[model samples]
Target: MPRIFTAIEIPADVAQTLTFLRGGLPGARWIDPENYHITLRFIGDVDVHVAHDVASMLDSVNRAPFDLRLDGVASFGGRKPRSVFANVAPSQALTDLQAEHERMMQRVGLEPEGRKYTPHVTLARLRDSSSRQVADYLSERGSFRSAPFRVERFVLYSSRASTGGGPYIVEEAYPLAAIPAKRAI
Candidate 1:
């Protein structure tokens, strides 16, 4: 059984920018640039039948393509930081898309996601790094930002069941609705 999830693939140029934030902090296992993505929903290992249900259900999602921007850098877990990430600037379109995924998963018999959704791209996983170390790192590089990137589609990705930061395979992709061109008066 493959561990599956839905996410937006980071463009190469954006990923390259994120790579600059690597190193500097000890005990940080930096994620490979190619693996960078903004996860929409995390669906843990499920049976082949359930996976099929998920794939088919995702096809029904109708949303327009939207632009996303990386605004800053932040860390999760507060006092005992677990991972560092590039914060995604808040967008209602992104939130609505994610909410739809959550609802769809629950309709497929998966339980509700307990944590509130906070969209971000994981940069590194901290192992034994202290609070001071993480704070100092954030203090230096927390102002990181990236130019807005157009999100044309979302994908269903599969990964080996292990510690997160992926070697993800895109099993399928669902394109969002394209914006219509204005007609001449």
Candidate 2:
């Protein structure tokens, strides 16, 4: 059984910027560029049957593609700084999409994680780090932001079992609709 989740991938240009942000802070273990993603929902280790069920449920999902702006920087975990993240410019569309995903997963009998959905792309994980350095790091990048990127699809990924986070494998995918045709043909 592989730990799995659904997420939207950031484009290469945006990912290039996130990749550059890696390795700057002391005591931070930066995520590999490939692992940077905005997770919609996490469905932990599950049997093959569950994976297929989740995929089937996801296929019934309906949502238009949306633009997401990467705005601001933030950190999680007090004192020790467990994670560094790129925050999204709040969007109602993103919220609705996530909520739909949660509901769909729940209807499939999956145990939903009891946490509010906070939209973010995790950049790094900190260990053995003091708040002082973490605070400074946040202050330094507080104004940092990235241009909006189109979120055209979401995927069901199976995460490799590891203490360091993941080596996610795409198990299924649902592509969102293209932007409406301007002055339809």
Candidate 3:
């Protein structure tokens, strides 16, 4: 069985910006810069045959590439925060691509994802960090923003079934259609 998911790769420069925000919050297990990615769908543990089926279906997903940005910082768990993340600024193109993946997964007989689709690149896993600490951290870096990066492709990744955060392996990649450049007179 393999734990699979779909995601967009983060450009190294943007991941570098995220890396600078890593420290200062105690009890926070920071994620590696190389592992940063915006998840499209998490398709838990599945049989090898099913994984192959998913890869085939994903290869059929047809959507144009779109620009994406990391705009702000936020934490999960309202009271006792469990983790902190870099928000993926909203884009309808991104949403539509994700929705298409959801529909494709259902066609293959997988259970529908239970969580509402909130796109974010998780920054750190919080263990014993306090509300005060979380609030202060959010306050300090609330205005975090990155240069918009073009998402030319999305990938299917596999990881060992373990406590969240990864060591994700890119099992397959699906490229999006590129926009044509305007010809100058």
Best by lDDT: 1
| Model 1 lDDT per residue over 67-148, tens place | 9999999999888889999999999999999999999999999999999999999999999988899999999999999999
* Candidate 2 structure quality by residue, lDDT tens digits, 1-185: 86889998888899898876776688888888787789999888888888889888888776788899988888888766888899989999889889988988888798776998899999888887788887888888877789888888999888788876467778888998744555956
lDDT per residue (tens digit) for residues 1-185 in model 3: 99999999999999999998999898899999989999999898999999999999998777788999999999999889999999999899999999999998999999899999999999999999999999999999989999999999999999997776789999999999854666999
Enumerate residue pairs that collide in model 1.
none
The top-ranked prediction according to TM-score is 1
Clashing residue pairs for model 3: none
Mark the 10 consecutive residues where model 3 has the least summed lDDT.
173-182
TM-score of 1: 0.95
Off by over 4 Å in 2: 178-185
Query: Model 3 segments beyond 4 Å from truth?
Result: 178-185
Give residue 88's lDDT in candidate 3 (0 to 100). Answer: 93
Q: RMSD of model 3, in Å?
A: 4.3
On a 0 to 100 scale, what is the lDDT of residue 11 in model 1?
A: 100
